[model samples]
Target: MQYDIEADWHLLNTCNYRCGYCFFTADTLGDKLQMHASPQQWQSAFDATDFTWLLHMTGGEPSIYPLFAELCEALTKRHFISMNSNLSRPLQSFVERVDPSRVSFINAGFHFEERERRSGNAVFLENARLLQSKGFPLLVSIVATPSALARFEEAADILAQAGIVPIPKILRGSYNGQRFPEAYTEPDRDRFRKFAALAQESYREMLNTSGHPSIDMFGDIHLLYGEPSFTGQLCEAGRRFVNIGPKGDVIRCGGPTVYGNVLAGTFKRAKRAKPCNTGGCIYFCQKYTSGPSGPQETRSGFFDWVADVIGTAKHPV
Candidate 1:
């Protein structure tokens, strides 16, 4: 059977930090990225359809868009809006202005390299604590790397000590066109899973442990000690969800803009076109589509699918 439809419309390509692993990394968004979507296009897209359960507003960084608040106000008028932000902005002002209930929760991604090297970690932590204290629903997203696991736990500890509860969303490592898998040797995955299990015990206990609400945006959230299990049908992106790029480009999936532009037509028609860069789709999305079946083939069932894409940054270009 087919599935419910959701749309992830990429509002702009403006971001404050140029993260290494981001799909719309500086290098990637370098040429095509722009803040240029007409009001007519917005209304047409909004009026032309009905299955937009979640209208995700993303950017190089949504806060920097200047008109983010206006966009949020516009979309919330029609759909349940979720703005994917790095939580690096003092958005309390912005949130208060928009539809509070329509705003799902902010996905706070702590850019460690930037925080440590560029903007001191102390300030970063303080910003996070401030958001948590305000009682804004939030999801903490961290990238998975050799040192990532330990750093994540440390960050969690710091947040807890500050009296903040955060849900950890672990993402696979994607860098300069490469992807990292959770093979047996990665001790970090094991440590994380144990931590997650502890968080599941109770809500209050989870504040100290992992229970903030862990989600894996990619298939590697959990490590399969033996063989991985596959469930649900392979994702046919356009049918399930669609992402409209900044310049009116409608991509089949978030992997890479590899299809028609909805501004030129509707999602139903966009699906008929082919992805412009299908071969180079990031690993997080590429593995699901037509690949060899095996014990390693990861599952994209209802549970796993949404978690993998919901708050994830675009794969690094």
Candidate 2:
């Protein structure tokens, strides 16, 4: 009952906000047609999996999907359900319909620029409180842009007062002629260090003092403070982890090409971990399939066991 398979489905490319640093730009969104799998399609895909899977739904914003609540209701019955959302939309309806126990967690992104726009901070906080009150494991995260970092203390204070700890994520792209995961300026590096320190402290005080056992904090520290070389390591893509596009095509980890389609019930051979041949490897992509032993031997082992009990393969990648 070692449920080792993990899938991250890019449900759609339609987001309500335009965060300046987002890789998914208006032009990028324009190039791709917005689409979602029907509930039946979701069921078929779940049914077709030879191993149990922890299914993650992500997009421009998953809450905006037309049948979001219905889809959640269906998926929760068969597999663990987790979502990456902006939390700009109301969640009472979703909370009422989907069982909280089946939800692995919700990663809510708080865009500082979007605070003044639709579903402002007040509404976002209210929704978050509602979800937490109902016993949902909610991880509130914010991008650590310089501007966002300037106001982070205030935001952190507010969330801390309400029994919620905010996790600060390193901003992914570049700014002011500097690229990320490669060419961060001294000031940029300092800002991220300060943010991570604050987040670690807050996590200890407000959440669990022991921290997440499976997460390697040292690895995170190295990612920010030092250059990690994955240049020629065997990356376990297509075997234990994969990225499924909106149309159900599977990509090896975050690779550029589609290997197969899950809905077609055709799975390509699980490729052996190979030496990374790309120019640069981003942390997210590297973390997903980096080690030769695969996710089962690392951070996702707990979910693997949980999936065995629930009769599905579960892991988050």
Residue by residue across 179-288, what tens digits does model 2's lDDT show? 65445556765666666665566555323632342122312333443344445556655666667888788876557645688777776637566665443324333445
Question: What is candidate 1's lDDT per residue for 1-317, written digit by digit as tens?
Answer: 11144456677776767766676657554544455665445656665665454565666676766566666666666666655667666665665656556655566676665555566456556656765566555555555444656676676666576554333345434554445453424475565565554333323442344222212332234332221232223444555456667766776654454446555654452343232233222322333333335212543343244345443322210
Reference-based TM-score, model 2? 0.79
Kindly report which residue pairs in candidate 1 clash with one another. Answer: 14-61, 15-60, 15-61, 23-314, 23-315, 199-211, 217-308, 258-275, 258-276
For model 2, what is the alpha-carbon lDDT of residue 103? 72
Q: After superposition, how far is residue 277 of candidate 2 from its true place, in Å?
A: 4.7
On lDDT, the candidate that comes out on top is 2
